[model samples]
Target chain A: MQGGWHRYKEGVMTGVALVAVGGVLQAVVGRIDWSRAAFPVNLLLLVLFLAGLGGMHTFRSKVGLFDRLGRLPASVSALGWVMGVTVLMGCIRQTPSHLLSDGVEVWPDFSRMLSSWSFVLLYVWMTVVLGLVILRRIYPFRWSKIPFLLHHVGLFVVMVTATLGSSDRKCLRMTLVLGELGRFAWSETDRRSVELPWTVELKEFVLDEYPPVLVLMDKETGKALPAEAPLRWVLEAGVEQGGFTDWDLKIVRSIPEAVPVAEEGRLDFVASRSVGAVYAVCLEAVHRKTKVRKEGWVSGGSFMFLGELLELDEHVCVAMMDREPRRFASRVVLNGGNGVRKEGVMEVNRPLEQDGWGMYLLGYDNAKGRWSDGCVVGLVYDPWQPYIYAGILFMMAGAVCLFVMAQSGKWKEETV
Target chain B: MSWDYFVYFAVVALAAWGAGALWAWRGRQVGWVYVFTLSGLAVFLGFILSLWVSLERPPMRTMGETRLWYSFFLPLGGLITYVRWKYKWILSFSFVLSLMFICINLLHPEMHSKTLMPALQSPWFAPHVIVYMFAYAMLGVAAVMAVCLLWLKKGNPGEREMTLCDNLVYVGLAFMTLGMLFGAVWAKEAWGHYWSWDPKETWAVATWFGYLIYVHYRLEVHSDCRKSLIILLVSFALLQMCWYGINYLPSARETSVHTYNLN
Candidate 1:
């Protein structure tokens, strides 16, 4: 009895230490905003503190209620219930179209439902039951307990962190115009405008396009043929198109930007270094049956057709230009109210993080290519990110431990 | 390599898988079964490698591209299970499932463009997808084993069968956990949020929780084989939804960043 008492005291101390560590981590991670009374952090601390103390054998031995609640059947049933409800919610959220058609706002409605009193009660009840079951099962930890502890504890930590951090999480869309400071963002939940703590000035916006390709099309049917040529093909002195059509077309020259010039009473093409320019291809075509040769410049947004009758030939031969935007990015300078300044490049999949805020390049003005007016960025402020990351790390470590323990062949010798 | 070459290799690989299944059924020398199956896997891997080399990127960008890896891993997983448990019918079931995916690829060939979108050109893209596909393969095998257990005489599965099923679930769950963690980490880097609650993500978490419940149920209840089998089957269906069924969700089509423009 004396030895059991000593062990119980040690467990209690350990539990207290664990909860204390969690509280300190929360404070350090900014999860506990003291300015707001840190209610969420305090609530989490209280819950963990109670859980830690209850995990002690001394406390557990004094309370018959925990033992009764720790019944395996009850825990399993509670888990099933939670999983069922969560899945149902998830299924409903998966059909956004249905929700929209039903006049239900997806995220807000889902969030409201999750935070509703009934849902909260259910969530808390199941969490408590599950936690008790895990605590009871893991009290006398052995090698075999590693997998169970990792999986369950990791899950509990993640869910708790997510819940505690939800109210502090904020997402907004910010549009930055070139050469102008942007200090306002539209809330993602609602389109209401909100002022940000920092000003973002777009230094420049760049759009990169893939190499242009020339496509052959049947003007009559308006159907594209399979024949395609790269921009390099324009540089070639001549090229044959017999495989694509009955006409044989030869490229005379190509220019990135072409402007027409009248030389000797005939039209000629010359390269122009203009801000807004179109790709131009000068070609010579020979009719297969008539053996007549013709030459002209076919610029992007300009049409050229070849045939016996001008109108009839217009339906027989056509050329189309195509190019896809490969990537877009924004160079921006962020000026914070705290007098901190930073410069960063924001691109898709590469976000700019500064002073607890992340700015992601969502898109750019499609009509203006390299000279776009500005870019659209999504700004996110999540105080719970550190906790979430910690939870992920813990979960990953737990998973690895379980996997390694299983492979070490020691688990088979220990009976659950 | 071109789609034509892919088709040729796929046909040959499927033929080999069929022959291996025949040998397994006949109770022929295990060496011949190993030879046929391993050769099939080799050919399949070669096809993937060729496509990767030709495309100048990992063949994990498109739905059909990822399906190629799934087709390969499913049989590989079944072969491993068969070798471990000496289960005769495992390879045949794996072959049929693999054939279905291969046929899907043949019927609806997607654009095999050489260019990968900037978002897909990340270091995490390959491992995140590869691990998920491997986990799916393991779970697929587990589901097959559960079905076999369910069909046993009087629905009474022997201890050996139960152990096999449990072991499969354990390994599959570990892989699933790893895959999910990798994906979350990748998403944090690319999308600025670790958990967006996207439709695919929601389904994935639901599937994970479903399996979690199954594990707890098996441990706590000491349930009968039929009940366990049902749980596994249901978990497998959730896995399917997480994998591709989410694509059919209209909300996902509009809002999910993960959707693949297969057309």
Candidate 2:
């Protein structure tokens, strides 16, 4: 068992099989996510990744492949890889068109997610068994080292906590204001309702503000074209040192149009003034004679043209404008997460409770008048807050223990 | 404390980085050189970040806080690596990364700051974001180590470093996995769902899987493990793409709660 292949077949393989059995049992009856087709889809792709590498034969044939290919020579290489990867994912995340096309609507609230039996199953299996199996195979059941023993014990703690404390819970979406506390209605009529213990009210809520973030792009990369600057709205305006004087640069806004957010708020408006880069666009113009042309920055309406907006994805447009700045009806923005009773009173974060339910502050709709003002809040009534907290604590402890052990192996080597 | 002065900070950082790079070219005691250069550079950038935070009215609600994140990750990531390895050359990398983040942040400074909306005033938020960022810095290093170990293993056909490298990869994966799980738990507290199919969430899953691949790769160390290393590198890269990419895609953006309108 020099490389431990024999031990793996006898001990680790069977252990893995036992873990798989647990997964299978749970997949059938434990949780919804694992049972569903999506879980298999995830696994299948993973399997394919392994298959592409020629399976165990290839893995076992090479020694120290990890040391060579797992990392770059220096930290800069690592950062470069990370940056390259970040940009790649960013492109995927910010698709020019929706990956799932054809006006695919969200499944109305989080039902598709929370109530997903398939996801629950897969999540449970992954959390409890796969992670443990991997750990056990690596560290085994031996209580030889302190770090090793702690790790083994820690994994057990995480499992107990996730399971006993708060594995099953649900929430609802609500719209409310400060003084006018309301009730939470469940999305599915069949689902059981949870009621809050107190008559709560949202006193006030505020969006933590930040400064205009600077963005840089390579001149050659399509990320930022000096030759073809987009019609950029002022997402923000700030004064910073430039050369000798503090140069005031206005950040162009770029808000991707998302529906769940829009639907939650009956009324919505782009931050016309400049909260952040809510929207931006890149355009190409033909020069008078040369192929090159002058590209200047302007909002969609910053210039006069029926220019098409650059839709970052099918759903949201990082373009000229979402909807031209319109006068909101309410002076007090009633966000889904905020509650307001009038100009004098405000509510947010705190729920406005009434009846047998609580109305949480989810978000607010930009408005110009009384009728237009709107807000949305996520509502939940967990009878297991304390249990959940306990479980979280256990999970954190287990995780922290696991982390410390992994980092302190060198220390262990010295001690041994 | 002006943001403009910080631009100079970036220049200084780059100079330090370049100097360190030059030192590396000369094959001298570069780790301390790298550390001193980056430490000074990051502190300068951090000072600017403090100034930005103290602004009477910050204009940083959008992805516009690019420079701020730069200041944040560079010094932060640099400090973390310095603490872990204390290697001089490694410190040089920190300076380089911090400068990169700063440069990127400066590029989009015009569009980020926004007025405080009603929802963002919660005390839990800053801590959440700050912890998450630091964790990311730590995990980022781990991911890098994983890649480096794998690559080195590949270069040395039957070197003794392979097992140790595998161990390092495992270590990184463990930390990152924990961080991902922690983030999910935090989400449950802040929002309701412990898991959302937001782009960030999905990509996080992918990243975790990448870690799993490394684990499996460890088991098969006596075999062709280059593929596994490639997977780790690829997966880590995907993590970056996911963070920046999902913002542009409208469907993912429309459904996701994590972005806070980053796109």
Candidate 3:
């Protein structure tokens, strides 16, 4: 029992010593420049790391520490340390590297935990422990160990590939304007414009917006009425009705596309699909307490007009809020530099893959809404994603085994 | 279909669950307990189905919508646990916890809308969210079991009860793993990256690690009942942060894409 306690204490000291070395290295060398380890460098490092791990496992009988580190105490300590660092990572606000150049004041090391040498070293230590665990189980393995192997090896693959392959992953953005051929894209990492192999021209942009909503606004503060838990009624042309806070409201008429018109000293809206058209609604509101009625045409307005509201009283009025976009897509014609042409629609959550690149719709001009003629597309090329998916599959299989084992009471109970 | 009729469905489901709990506590007519519990599930599921149809999409977008799933799963978990372990008190505990969520929903209803954003219109949305809700329900049951086995039972829990709690955690972790993987795959398909280390993702990993430590400690190290039970409660607290505590964190509020537009 004394020997066992001493070994556990030694294992914890080793873990703490590793952390100290990491902190010292972090202070000396600054953050790890991952881009410096791209491609062959990462591959070489991985090979060396594995070779060392295998050598350690083979010499476990010779080195007392190797056998000790392979035991549960060391593994648990490593996991506990990882958990501690991860908790710290969650608490700190980690900024993306590209955004670091924006001149915002942030903690030097913690702000970029992913790139900090201490964080990287801690993960490397974890991988080493995990590698030893996997090696221990691999020798003289039975079918019963398959689930354990899957879980550990799967995690190992994900950690190794995601870390090393991150440097090779490329994310860039391209903008396509209607009727204009575009080939240049802005790389997110290095912040430079690069010409693409293919050109894309936006043929049409479609934006489907949800119907505008009406909120009772305080005429003085110009904010939603009732201050807390403000009520909103979605306008659906003569179909929906609701009451809120002493006011019964109804949509008398609605127009999806309309422009303001003035004729015979009366301001009204005419339905049109012309430029700068806005969503206009006719509302009738009744004050339940006072038995007073108010009616008028109101609009959330567009780039061309300031919105109009119906005065319910001196204190409050019925105001229209801007229509929220439900979905937006850009129809584009892609021309490969080699004379191949293809047409596709790119939308959020729907990426068009072509020539080893995924093109995802990122943004449109919020000011122009549906009338915007251009859209930003994010292009990404990640070769390591397939390996990551394989790892995910292995972990999923192991998880299934765990579930089944737990449910059937087949787990081998350790004697207490 | 809408929250307007939620009170009726809530009351009916509560009555069925309450009756099932009473029947379970009496330790008589197991068939009647199953009947009552299943009827409650069916009625609640029917309401969800109607809401899904009326909304023209899965009702998994808002905080209130997720609560609807939580309430449904709590009793469902209770029934499954009772079926597996024959725990008479499980139903009463789940029903009371589930009732609290139902009451909250009834009092503070959100605006009902049929508009689903473009980013949410993925095939992965429903399964990802539903699986997570189920996982949360299972873990919640484990936490309640921990509380009972620790405090209420005066830390003298039977081995069978302890094993049952462990098994619940196993099931919960299994589903949580799947849910996180699904989210990662969907994120890769939707966005450019699989994992962005966003605040929500960070908290989720912390939560996963917390439970992992408990599982390892219980399985390999000493199975001190008190220590394991305490670990369970701590892990549950981490899960709470991953669930809704991120919304209130200033660091998370601006950065997390997982934040639901609650209003």
- Give each prediction's DockQ, rounded to 2 decimals: 0.36, 0.20, 0.55
Q: Residue A149: error of model 1 in Å?
A: 2.4
Best by the TM-score measure: 3
Please estimate how well model 2 matches the true structure, expressed as its whole-model Cα lDDT: 0.43
Residue A137: error of model 1 in Å?
3.4
Model 3 residue A348 CA deviation (Å) reads 1.6
Q: Which candidate has the highest DockQ of all?
A: 3
Which tens-of-lDDT digit does each residue in B143-174 have in candidate 2?
55555566543463333334444444544554
Q: Which scores better on lDDT, 2 or 3? A: 3
CA-based DockQ, model 2: 0.20
Q: Give the poorly placed runs of model 1, Cα more than 4 Å off.
A: A1-65, A68-71, A93-121, A190-194, A213-322, A336-340, A402-416, B152-155
Error of 1 at A8 (Å): 32
| Tens-digit per-residue lDDT, B1-263, candidate 3 | 77788899989999999999999999999999999999999999999999999888899998889999999999999999999989999999999999999999988877777778788899999989998899899999999999998888864888898888889998898888888888998888888788999988888888887787777667654556777788889889989988888888766778888866645
Report the lDDT tens digits of candidate 2 across residue range A134-234. 33234334443444333433444444333332323335665556455544544432344444333234444343223222222233333432223222323
- 1 against 3, candidate with superior TM-score: 3
Clashes of each: 1, 144, 0
The residue ranges of model 2 lying beyond 4 angstroms of the native Cα positions read A1-124, A127-170, A173-184, A188-359, A368-377, A410-416, B1-3, B24-35, B54-103, B106-109, B112-116, B138-154, B157-190, B212-228, B248-251, B261-263
For every candidate, give the share of true A-B contacts it also has: 0.38, 0.15, 0.57
* Docking category of candidate 2: incorrect
The lDDT per prediction is: 0.69, 0.43, 0.83
